[model samples]
Target chain A: MSGGGTASPRHVITGIGAVAPTGLTCADYWSAVLRGESGIRTLTRFDPSGYSATVAGEIPEYTASRYVPGRLLPQTDRMTRLALIAAEEALADAGADPSAMPPFACGAVTAASAGGFEFGQKELEALWSKGGKYVSAYQSFAWFYPVNTGQISIRHGLRGPGAAVVAEQAGGLDAIAKARRHIRSGTPLMVTGGVDGSLSPWSWLCLIRSGRMSASPDPEAAFLPFDRRAQGAVVGEGGALLVMEDAERARERGASHRYGEVAGYAATFDPRPGSGRPPGLRRAITMALADAGMAPADVDVVFADAYGVPALDAAEAEALAGVFGPRGVPVTAPKTMTGRLLAGSAPLDVATALLSIRDGVLPPTVHVASPAHEHLLDLVRDAPREQRVSSALVVSRGQGGFNSALVVRAAA
Target chain B: MAPFPTFTTKQLVDLLRECAGEDEAVDLDGDILDLAFTDLGYDSLALFNTVSRIERDYAVELPEDVVGEAGTPRQLLDLVNAGIAERV
Candidate 1:
């Protein structure tokens, strides 16, 4: 696959920040992942007694006041607050100050699925009961999906190519891909990732209506992806963002704490099963490999989407088999411990993939003692598997036929 | 008519401090007269809310243009004084 265009500059992951279900920081989250600890527990944001799924991956004991000032709290929702904190951490980790850099040279792109649903719900309650005048003026901006990108840009003074991706669960990967494009096209740096908290009754109800949520009340079994008992995924809340920069620029700045390089990425749509077309995940994986100038054998580990639905699981397994041949690759879905964070899911997976490359260890998929897929792929379970991970293939499938694949390679 | 209610510099500073929240970096002894609300660690929205509270408490309507033009505590105080004099 050749094209008549300037070769894009290599994009490297210089920093990582996360507010995940297991922990608030990337180190804590990675520690929990290595221990195979599950973040899924009984829902405390709201009463789930009457709901189908009573458990979810809720952030334990999160206090936004610790990160956001009181003056700005009313104007920010949980989603934006999480994004702001994660972006700050990522920038600090990269030793890059947006204020010190040319404002237009720095940019941001984020993914949001249910834009501030908790805040919007409050405004709607006020409108329905206390009348329109009682609704908050902040609602006008805080409840929008693009508000995450807007707030991050304003807070950091990043005037460069700012945007948001709303591709459902695949939006995280899409946002990273867009960030890579922006960097290659002249933007010096970008803060890109995804964060969402939809555990509120209104948000959870919306998720339940989609028929994808697991009805199990057991926390451990609620989101058993790729397991025979996999009913469906439990909705989780959290997000992770990364600071991506040009490889040469980072090295020139003497930045030593590098995670990995975003080698390649590709996206496709599944278009339902019976459109007389093949599954899109396999094509997306193949294209991503080609984009990275790599082969199937070059990939050391596969980060499965692990939707926790029977049909979707089978389809994903088949796609993996088609790419790497029968049981040709080691696969894992660490999201089993974090539930499915919707838009935040893929970004967190990307973060974990980078960490896997750094540590040369494949994080375990929690609570999968028996492999469910008949294809017999090597699934990492029980404990972290030690391996020389040079490249990782992270794949995600969204609700509305969105399939995305990203290849992250160990730092050069 | 009842004597127009007047605020001392200290009272005004206290009000600003209260409106800005305890966590804000509002300096009571610093150049409050020249410092912008943002410099005092209050965003534009917070300043608006503070202005609204001042109007309700003082029974005077601040001019609409004051929201954008009043960058300093001195400008805000002048606007309130003008409103008081006009009512008188």
Candidate 2:
């Protein structure tokens, strides 16, 4: 096949930043993942005694004020604050100076499944208890989904295209994909990813209604993805963002670190069960591989969504079987330890994939001692797998049928 | 009658530095009588917080109208003085 049109400028991840349940920084999170450590524990953010789920993957110790400026604290939600910290770290990691680039040559794109739920809940409480007059003016924008993109751009003086994706669990990949598009279209750089904190009473109540969360009180077994005894997922808090830059521009800027290249991306939707169509995950994976001009065999590792629901788990395995056949690829779901972060999950998976490619090691799928079902796939478990991982495929499926897949290749 | 509590531009500068952070370039000795809050790195939200802190310390509530009208430190100081006088 002849390559048409100067193939869109290749995009590379120049920097990565994460605020996950296991750790506050990308290095800490990746270290915990390699050690097969689980961040799940008893839910102390609130008294879960009244709720069905008592365990969660909460960040060990986080103070938003530590990262956000005091002047901006009143205007920021926890989610936005987390995003800001991650963005700052990613820019530093990439050694990107937006001011050095043309002001309009850099942009920001963020994914947010739940926009400032904790902040909105607090505002609602004040309104109900103390009347409208007591409500904060910051409530108007802090609870907005696009507040992260706006804040990150304004803080760094990025005047290029900015957007926020709200595709639930799939939104994180979508944000990264959009950032890649932006970089291809003349933007030199983009700060993109998803971060969320929806552990408040109201957010938890809404999640409970979805019927996908594990109510197990035991932290070790609460969120067992791909295990025969799997119940459901645990709602996790925190997220990650990445600094994506044009490969050539990064090189020109003397950036010494490059995580990986965003080779290709594709998104699909699962029709309702009765629609008689194959699972959308298979299509997403196939499309992503094709977009990357790669074959299934080119992928070194597969990061499964691992929703932790039995039916969903089986369906994902079946999708993998259809794509790479039974035991076709080495698969892992480190999220079993971090719990399900909703939209924030996929970006962390991408970050993990980049680290895996860089270090040539695949992190294990913690807590899955027994195979959930018969499948033709090598599921990494118990201990980390050290191997040559030049390219990785990360997949995500949102609750409302959104499916997305991304291909990350080791920087050449 | 009790004496009215007074506020100086230096005190206002100090409050801004304390609330916004000492690293922010809030002119301490410059002629800030006509400088807007934004000039001092104070957005509307930060300005509101500064006003709240002053209210808490002075035991007086600056009117919402006064807050909206006071754009500079001098204007804010005048409003605070007026509020303290009314409260006393």
Candidate 3:
């Protein structure tokens, strides 16, 4: 449980940067979440009316030029630009200067489930309308899944061990788990999480192919997780990035605050259909608590993956029911405010969990008035639950059955 | 057919400025014709996009390695003008 055969350094999240649909910064996003404001509305990026699902959780009033250098604008995708902005905000919030740190002491690990779909769609259009040569050379790396890690590393000069996870929605927690590995393996800092977008028309076409996106035109009715009206997820863009620093290093560097500690993490995969084995979420939850040297009762709140599909929602409810029993724990899904953000959503939930631990309030699952799983879940709806939150468990299940659980607790 | 408009040094400089965007730290308008693109803050990727822009804008295709071959604005201009001449 230690790094380099020494005592395991406590890996704590010192800073957070978020670019969710509801808000642009960590403070703004938290405020919007607490207010129960929904960012889901009609898609203005294009005529999404032509598509089955018209509403989306696009980041409001975002201009990449304001955050990124002009030189990087033409080369990077909207996804990477969003990540760069978040990383900058995170480093600034953590007050850790990578340039001032030792060589190779910092790293970055990000997740990307939909690798620059907007950028790829643009290039594909050029190829179709004109020719292959018209495609931007930047497309080579921009559309690739790991470019977020590469861009963040390059931007922040994080030359330490770096990686990118692509396990769909589960990828965020998986990415954070990877960051913990580096922190435990002696790396001092990691800028980790997932920010993803594939919101263009071409990618929209591909998204519906999964049969998981909600086709409802009404924004309020589009995503009703744990409700009978639950149709499917409204795909969203934007996520969060957090600065995870070793405890001693954060203290030595005079970091202003510790958001929380990454107490434990575990990931599992659902058994394929027709297999006798059960879904892995319950096991993941149990194993993560054990890793944190805590029990299920110790968790204060549960941030669900909240796949709005009825069967998936029921399965998640069943998982929570199995772990904490029906109505044993308070559960919420603020993503109802900002649809599901693919790989980015889980990390957003994790960030929200840390904020919950910091502020001692549980953000609500908005828009789901009637709880279909009231017998199975103490779903925190409509109002912020003002309770002391010390530790939280974030549960996420990616497309193709990737399941992950992460435990974040207040610093001891 | 008349050769595509001559790819002049001024034109290349204008394109480079447009490609990389006019940044305050590095002046794309200075005496940058002989200086390496990297020295001018235009990395390989920037050069790639500039080259791609040149191709699409002028409708004259240069060799794929034109970017690799042209390290400076002058070199890029030479390659682009040659491609323009070949379009005659």
Scored by DockQ, the top model is 3
DockQ of candidate 2 compared with the true complex: 0.27
- Candidate 2 deviant stretches above 4 angstroms: A1-6, B1-35, B48-68, B84-88
Per-residue lDDT of model 1, residues A1-412, tens digit only: 3211347676689999888889888999999999999999999978999988899999886677788665567777787888888888888889988788876889999998879998899889978986764566578788999888998888788899999999999899999988988888889889998887777889888899999999999888888778889899887888789999987888888776789988878999886767888878889999988888889999999999999998889889999998999889999998998888989989999999999999999999987756787465778887999988989999998898999999899887
Listing every candidate in turn, what is its Cα RMSD in Å to the true structure after a full C-alpha superposition? 3.4, 3.0, 2.3
Ranking by DockQ: 3, 2, 1
Clashes in model 1: which pairs?
A: none
C-alpha lDDT of residue A97 in model 3: 91
Model 1 per-residue lDDT tens digits across residues B1-88: 7877774566667665555443445556666788776777766766675676577667778888776878888888888888877876
Chain B TM-score list for all models: 0.80, 0.84, 0.85
Task: Give per-residue CA lDDT, model 3, range A312-390, as digits (tens).
Answer: 9998999999989889899999999998988899989999999999899999999997788999999999999999999
Error of 1 at A362 (Å): 0.2
C-alpha lDDT values of all predictions: 0.84, 0.85, 0.88
Tell me chain A's TM-score in each of the predictions: 0.97, 0.97, 0.97
DockQ of each: 0.24, 0.27, 0.54
Candidates 2 and 3, the one with greater lDDT: 3
lDDT of 2 by residue, A1-412 (tens): 1111357687678898998888888998999998999999998878888888888888765776678776667677777887888899999899998987886989999998989888899989988996765566678788998999998998888899999999988999999999988888879999999887787889999998899989899998888888888999897877789999888888888887888987878999888889897778899999998888889999999999999999999989988878988889999999987888878899989999999999999999988877875565689997999999999999999988899999999887
Task: DockQ winner between 1 and 3, please give it.
Answer: 3
